[model samples]
Target: MADVILYRWSTERDTWVSASEVEEARAYLARQGITTSALPDGRFALAGESARAFGAERLVFLGLQQLRGTRSA
Candidate 1:
């Protein structure tokens, strides 16, 4: 399993939209002039500007750290 980070963006009208994929999330952040950084723990961290723009109330991390281990089956 791959460790993927999820993100949700809020429009100016206050409507929220969830990213369907990692790339989508990245693109959205990029469009907002946000830069993402890879942390040593194998997680992505949003830049300060991005974080502020995303708003603590509007940003959500779904299933974060759920893919920390390999699946056996």
Candidate 2:
């Protein structure tokens, strides 16, 4: 398995939205003027070096890659 990171933007709205409900919420991100890319293993990498050069927290986007070893499917 490979480690993946997801970059998430803070919501300016006072309310919350469900993940499934906001899967197509790229528009909300465009409003922030930040360009992001969703990477393999469900990770999101920063497209720019501005704002904060940070990685994901709580295994949300900073987990180590699972080494390929002997295993049976």
Candidate 3:
């Protein structure tokens, strides 16, 4: 099974948003003027207080399945 990493955004009006891709999350961070540095471990390190102010966290989505064929009933 493969795992996917996603970003969870802060709640708003009892609702929340998540970024499904790295670029998507980076775009949002960039808009907030939050800089991210690449770590030697292939992970990102958020810069400054934006980390706390952003209120976003990394989440792991596991056991994702992509069905390739239609089911026969």
Scored by lDDT, the top model is 1
Worst 10 residues of 1 by lDDT: 1-10
Q: Write the per-residue lDDT of candidate 1 for residues 1-73, one digit (tens) a residue.
A: 1222222222253333344444455555565565665445434667774343332223333222222221331
The residue-by-residue lDDT of candidate 2 on 38-71, one tens digit each, is: 5555535555744434323312222211112212
Residue-wise C-alpha lDDT for candidate 3, range 16-43, written one tens digit per residue: 3243444455554555565665555545
Model 2 spans with C-alpha error above 4 angstroms = 1-25, 49-73
* Pairs of colliding residues, candidate 1: none
Model 2, C-alpha of 63: deviation from truth (Å): 21
Model 3 TM-score on a 0 to 1 scale: 0.37
- Prediction 3 global C-alpha lDDT: 0.37
Q: What is the C-alpha RMSD of each candidate to the true structure, in Å?
A: 13.3, 15.4, 13.1
Instruction: Report residue 68 deviation for candidate 1 (angstroms).
Output: 29
lDDT of 1: 0.40
Which residue pairs show collisions in model 3? none
lDDT of 2: 0.34
Ranking by TM-score: 3, 1, 2
List the candidates ranked by lDDT, beginning with the highest: 1, 3, 2
What TM-score would every model get versus the actual structure? 0.34, 0.33, 0.37
